[model samples]
Target: MNTRDLQAFVAVVDSGSMVAAAAKLHLTQPGLTRRVQNLETLLGMPLLDRQSKPLKPTAAGRDVYALARNVLVAVDELMAAGAPDSEPSGELRIGVPPFLSELALERPIDRLRDAFPRLTLRVTAGWSPALVQGIERGALDVATVMVPASA
Candidate 1:
């Protein structure tokens, strides 16, 4: 229902117990449990099997959990993008030819860091085919590949 509830649910899933989730979330166990309970109440179904030694998600829980995780990720990305220009940060995954990567990345990366201290740049170097595959697979957001002039 809310970010806190979703976060609590995720923490419980990750930690495998309410106590552990509370510790991870820096909240009291009861508070964390209540958050999870509230979420289940809102959804009108039990999310976790408390009888299990290590809490396990029910089928419904697993489905809700997946959606909650995605929602939280989207919210975080939205918040990050909406942040002020002072916090100009993004993850840029790029693929480049080995030689071009070696030559071109240094000065541009340095200049980018100077301009936007929080920016994170990830560069992967590979042959043309691999670079192109990475781009197609979405592993690389952008890529530069060399093709024969005749082709």
Candidate 2:
């Protein structure tokens, strides 16, 4: 299967909306749909439940989603290994608690944007526990959590 097709499928599942996924990938909606359909065709099963308000994955799609995430991560690492000095691009998922997001991250985030113009940052704000959970689940690449000083 094509990596682009897998990427498209993962993006669609991640965003839960074709329009959002298409915009994220810089593809037209029709193009995104076709890629996903291509993947579904290869698998011989519908990956998305079209009847839902926001698209959701079918059971097989969930399994594919998990595997695809690992595949994408591995592919990225493999490419990076070959180009040690390559300019960073693609999505960076970050998690921060709402308070920390308000207080500490603005300047650093701005510097990151300036340094890697091609990189897309997708940030999620939540409680520290949930943010940690996100990182563990691979939903977040990195996160900041407050630890008690006494601990």
Candidate 3:
């Protein structure tokens, strides 16, 4: 019925259970269940087969799911089409991990160049601590740093 409802239904289907779906959607289990229930009510048909283990969507749900997915995809493309950030035209300084030896970062860099003709990118490979410091000091615009599990 709505984008949120469609997203909820798709997330539920993709995740395969109310609890898992709830976690994926960052909603409470009962809240997610209510969304699905509400959707069913709106459509006047049960979208999920509650009687089955690892609950599956009903036939109507499948049809709705396909359309909902396509609709969401179209909406995303439409939204992206008008976004000014898509044509980013600024210099960027980013840091990567120092331990990475000759990182295979060219493909993405090439893609960025193709996407933003006027954008300039400067990259520095450094230790996480140094990268974080650079970011905090405004020396680097952005940095990808790995946080050790121990931290």
lDDT of 2 by residue, 61-131 (tens): 99999999999978987897799899897789999989878668888889999999978898889998998
lDDT per residue as tens, model 1, 1-151: 6899999999898878899899988999999999999999999999999999799899999999999988886886798867755465667788888998878788987888888786678989999999889988888988888998995
Q: Tell me the whole-model lDDT of each prediction, alpha carbons only.
A: 0.88, 0.92, 0.83
Instruction: List the candidate 3 regions with Cα displacement exceeding 4 Å.
Output: 87-151
Candidate 2: C-alpha RMSD after superposition: 4.2
Go through the candidates in order and give the C-alpha RMSD of each one to the true structure: 4.7, 4.2, 14.5
Sort the candidates on TM-score, descending order: 1, 2, 3
The whole-model C-alpha lDDT of candidate 2 against the native structure comes to 0.92
lDDT of 3 by residue, 12-113 (tens): 888778889899989998988888888889989999888877878999989988988888867766766678567655568988886552566777888888
Worst lDDT run of 10 residues, candidate 1, spans: 83-92
Compared with the true structure, the alpha-carbon lDDT of candidate 3 equals 0.83
Clash pairs of candidate 1?
A: none
Candidate 3 or 2, higher TM-score = 2
